[model samples]
Target: MAINIMLATAMQPLGFLSAGWLADWAQPHTSGPGRGAALVLLASGVLLVVWGLAGLRYRPLRHLEDLVPDAAPPPEADADLDAVQNRVLAA
Candidate 1:
């Protein structure tokens, strides 16, 4: 989640740089096609960054079973596991 946030934040600067370059290259035409393109890129970049931050809000919990912290298999299950291990070792 943190990594995603960082990446999305990174896109903002990249989008700005690209838009600046395009606007400069367009010169007088910048107010026409270049400006429109820059606006689109800027908007899209902002959306990406916002989306990444939203991911943090939806991250899953690591431990769902909070009622029992020391939960374990029954003793019978442990004994069966041991028996299986012993048979494998003997073979």
Candidate 2:
């Protein structure tokens, strides 16, 4: 939950920064808005290709399924209040 919150908080600012960078990069080279859009698309494609190659080269990423353990099932809920209290006290 905390990790998700942190990621959500960071993503918007990072997005704005990337958008600013793309605008700065595309503005000088392109004549029109359409050209700038095309440049952004081209940049995205290149980034995707690089990301794919990186995933291929990284061994841990490739073996992630084997490395990480599956989550344990949750404990069953106790209905009786006295029994629950006793278990809690014992623990």
lDDT of each: 0.69, 0.80
Q: 2-79 in candidate 1: lDDT tens per residue?
A: 996999798889868787666565556546655756765676689889976776565453233454466686656756
Q: Candidate 1: deviation at residue 29, Å?
A: 14
The deviation in Å at residue 42 for candidate 2 is 1.9
- TM-score versus the correct structure, for each prediction: 0.32, 0.56
Candidate 2 residue spans exceeding 4 A from truth: 1-5, 77-91
Question: Best lDDT goes to which candidate?
Answer: 2
C-alpha lDDT (0 to 100) for residue 34 of candidate 2: 66
Q: What is the C-alpha RMSD of each candidate to the true structure, in Å?
A: 11.0, 5.9
Each prediction's number of clashing residue pairs: 0, 0
Name the TM-score of candidate 2: 0.56
Residue 15 error, candidate 2, Å: 2.3
lDDT of 1 at 22: 63
